[model samples]
Target: MNRKTLVLPAVVGLLAPVLAACGGSDSGSSGGDAIVVGTTDTFTQLKTRPAPLDPAYAYDVGTWNVLRQTVQTLMAYPKGDGAPQPDAAQSCGFTDSGNERYACTLRKDLKFSDGTPVTADDVKFSMERALTIKDPEGVFALLSTIDTIETKGDRQVIFHLKTADATFPFKLSTPVAGILNPKDYEKDKLREGFSIDASGPYTLKAEVKDKSMVKAVFTKNPNYKGLLDVKNDKVELESFPSADAMGEALSKGDIDVMARAMTPDQIDKLSAKTNGDINLVEMPGLEIRYLGFNTEADSVKNKAVRQAMAQVINRGQLVSEVYGTQAEPLYSMVAATVTGHSNAFLNKYGDPSVSKAKTRLTEAGITTPVKLTMHYTTDHYGAATKKEFEVLQKQLNASGLFDVSIKGYRWQEDDYKTKEQKGQFDVYGMGWFPDFPDADNYISPFLDKDNTLNTPYVSNKIRNQLLPQSRREADRLSAAKDLTEIQDIVAEDVPLLPLWQGKQYIAARDDITGSEWAINSSSTLQLWELGRGVKG
Candidate 1:
């Protein structure tokens, strides 16, 4: 799923003082009170597809945050760093030596939000429907490894893969593998409306919508029998019109917590202890921002044009001038914190040079002052997105070899369908929040034949040879060589340019507990970990 951009302090030392000052041990076992959490992330309901809450159609962070509470997957991520633990399954493992065939045994007497029993047939049905429907905006691409799913009796489910894929277990830990009740969902179509029937810690009580989702209400599920402990009785997720509105809701005592939508200025003020009643918590994030070029567009179709643009843009100046201390320049599509990261882009392009950029364009016999259009989402990311694009336009126009125009569109209403999916722009900005914490997750989705970018980037070496070799290795770290080669190939092809990576931050009133644990490493909100506590 893609994430909305949020900024945090780049230096880790700056958070030490703030963490020490806001010290109180929260066991997530406090007062069972209802809390209102506010964010700027909104949802859209399309006429041709199902609602955003359906597991088959949701591919954004905002909708998955809600689904994490209502839909249970076979395996789940622990609070920090570790292997995935069983949630709905009692035991699961690869049955073959080649990591191709996997099997799981369901826990005895598991029930959904309704009183229906959860069987192995329902698990098989849920996965098959997602792959069969193949929603254009969905995460079915993550399930491309499975060749078949088989159910044995009523308690066991087995998966047969086309090839050896070591990352299949991690994929099952994501929300895309969420098990659905067979009776509530169609066999080959997305379930309409916002209602869901699943076995998780919380249930969807109600939703408020106005063209897009405005608010959602979640309560404790009576029939939920899972491995997680539910700490809160109820939670109200409210979507504010803007970042300022969300921050004001926290200040006015209307909302108990503010998650992932604060502007850089707001974050700075909070970090300086301007608000005595609020506390800020920072977590390590794997979020990244990059620019994708339309390979078929007339202006950027030539590989030399994309390579020249990559060489001319200055990442250091962009981060310092616009983002202040909130972000760091990224040199690889795989984030620096990941296992197999390298400075492939930095090694290829070095520092920004206008002379080198001009020489590359001239050698290709391309015309001077190349015309291109750059597009970005106006409302989805944050207020700084507009300024970010403005700085990009200034830099490109100053290079004297390119003519650039910048445009902004609202994400839900205009940008997603009309602009991005249709490839209406020469170059566009996009953000990625990883589906799982793996280097393969970073490389495959953008460069594969059927990619999420909606642009064709056909790299036969990457899709056929390198990717297959990497997936066959059981130890993921041993596949670093193949992953490094993939990054170097991307640097040469220049299908996308890596820009900056961000850290995660959350702010809440003093009475609210578990703000630190609400969002996991994969950026999914675990609402069951939140509760109200005594005021300091």
Candidate 2:
């Protein structure tokens, strides 16, 4: 996904000592600098390596964090702003009027980390592999508009489209479009042997532990010829079992940076220090935490019951009292930063009145004591999730309109065994970080017939008609008109309720320079950017 402009200059926040001398010094002069970054996010491990190391076979942000640094795509997000720029390509842009045909010229003398030449055939092979393999979590669906790929010379590659898609440029900048070495991977099989031929800033330094890579090391890629100035000699990424463990590591100086899954209380405690120790990079976030309703469930089948539940939930209290300033109450599934977003729930529900909720239930012939069972993951999201869901239970039960029963599940086992709940639950919690910044990514994934929600939501207009029409429109703002209607439809139907939009926070040790530019559009950290700060 493309992102908004970044504001992480060398400004001294809580961590004054690290960034205090960043005004005039050359960034690359210092050598042999290294840093350790801790992450609490869950990773999908395959065959001992980070599952996402292969661009054609991986998904999830944890994998994205590693891939974004190790793999180079045709285009990439610039550090200052999340705008797209040529990465392996000398230049790339749309070549035709129908908003379909896109072309790129590969950079001359480009080579993999192993010194093998990068050619147009490699690019074609990578794209073809991703499309043919059809990894369920892969980027195949995102590139559905591509009709054909044609290579002209050794340097030029052209993509013909079946429909007009202005967002195709943004698509190329994603990890899915990462060019691969054809010699290492086959057309339909995922690459094995823990071997990698990197084309980006850093290369994996060791063979990852088989079937589990909770910790890994990386070094600068000597073969890299890209835009980023590599400031650090090495980077070590360590994953923890919980946010508290990660936070404690940062406090004890065991880790130089803490990336994702730091709780709100952890952030507050770090922010409270007057000493110049911890610096928190407040990243612009589009991640949404929402509640999905299973309309097939007898308890919530009625539209009135769903609408009443939406009306009674207090968003402001959820954000302020539970998440602190780290989150904002969301009114639409499409976040505030995106075009075509509106406060549809706010316009319909107003400020969470119990009396209004009661009236809504009464109209649907529901009694005062409506029964509901809510399910959420126990450890996957963060430590604060239990508290957040507890608050939600209290708010609903306080109205005297519901008898809510809450259930917890481990994330890995929850989806596979969902048939126990008859393919639906009364309500369930889920979090979404964008794959691409387009509003379509937010809606299309959740509401389609075989949606991730597992609900039998069959919206023919949204799936078969409206979304297809919007995708064909060349202008994004103009296409938003169709998307706006989709949001309104979703709000009225009330299958999902927008709970909150998160703010990305990275708590790093004060002595880490270039930490300001670590986070990319994918909300994943770039470890290559971290270096030891100049000491006073």
Candidate 3:
């Protein structure tokens, strides 16, 4: 059940490319008892009320970030790079061959922050409650494969899957699988409070508000019985309205570290200014930005047209001209750092070629000046998004195969609007931050019949068959071949075009130690790894 030695090392090995510059020193040192971390307004709420400490009801990055610190899961990603070892559970694995049945034995003497014992029954309640509530965007869909759950006495729990699933462990490692204090939460509702009743490395002390920002204060949790070495006595997370504001605060010594939501421009400026003022930790990226085609739209229905667009679009140009080294051109839906990643699009289309694009249109019997409209949320993605799309429009238009017009939408509408509402735009921009570190997470969410992309893409070979088969293989490396094939299918179908993979960066005061080690593949920071420096 303890597959840490074998499973994690393999996962880390596959991710070694991304972690190349991730290892090394702390950001200097300012001997202080408290550290203030500034980020975007992504961490404003503690919970949305009846289901207190329920991971199923919270889905945003902010909520997940806080929940990850307060609640323990069956398995968890370690400080640096390793497999998800046992956290709340002493050991866990499948009991049967099809990878259909899962079992976990609880760690002895587990307790919630309120002093209640965390037992197998609580684990069962936590998972089953998430499914029962069935919050459409919540963790329930992620756990939909679980057909039944059973608790054997006080220490053991079993999960009966509706079908074979190999990536179940990765699910167990997510915030969705975070265990709850059964006494503090109802089985079916959102819980409202600033209360900290769960068990993790930190305990919530208070929530403070300043203008548009919210600051969450935390102290080390005495009830936490995990393997992590908690380095700081107090951790304060300050949320801001904009990345620009956050950057200014970091420069003015208003905060100790800034983690998320800084623009590439901001990163460049901060990197250039790296001295005693601040230090930047460049972490590997699992995040991807891409172009999604609404195949249902009349303009993009022709496969040749899509292929032509692919041929003319220049990823290298986008990375250099727009994103700099903060991002790299991506040819596969699966990121380069993950196992089973293949550069299918690059192999098929090569570099940008106007002649190739024109030939594809002529072969398909499509007319000249195809007239394509691209859509992107002007407010959702960072400041670089508009420039990125504008550059794309120029590239496609310059090829003379088609006429491209660009449109913009607010973040709320762009995200929530159905294909019918946004029909005016044939091709649109999209981005994804992983729910887990697996390649399957990248493909399954966009290619399956009921895909998250909101575009109509029903691949029987992929959704109804291949992906399910891939999920049944317990060995991830063995499953890599199936995933690679899935990526090829995506390239051929062209529902979504892979654009670029991001580079994670953290800017912290020069005196902070442990800052370099905080960013991980989950795209979440390990606050416990950070400590105060020698000079405040």
**Candidate 3 C-alpha lDDT tens digits along 400-436:** 8889998887543333234323445578887777767
For model 1 the TM-score comes to 0.94
Q: How many backbone clashes does candidate 2 have?
A: 2
User: Which ten residues in a row are the worst by lDDT in model 1?
Assistant: 8-17
Clashing pairs in 2: 48-210, 48-211
The collision pairs in model 1 are none
lDDT of 2 at 139: 51
Better of 2 and 3 by TM-score: 2
Per-prediction TM-score to the true structure, in the order listed = 0.94, 0.88, 0.87
Name the top TM-score candidate: 1
- What local distance difference test score does each model get? 0.80, 0.74, 0.74
Looking at model 3, which ten-residue stretch has the lowest summed lDDT?
Answer: 1-10
What is the per-residue lDDT of model 2 for residues 137-170, given as tens digits with 9 covering 90 to 100?
5356666678899998889999998877777777
Candidate 1 runs further than 4 Å off: 1-21, 24-31, 48-50, 415-418
TM-score of 2: 0.88
Lowest lDDT 10-residue stretch of candidate 2: 8-17
Instruction: Give the per-residue lDDT of model 1 (tens digit) for 402-431.
Output: 899998888777745346767787799988
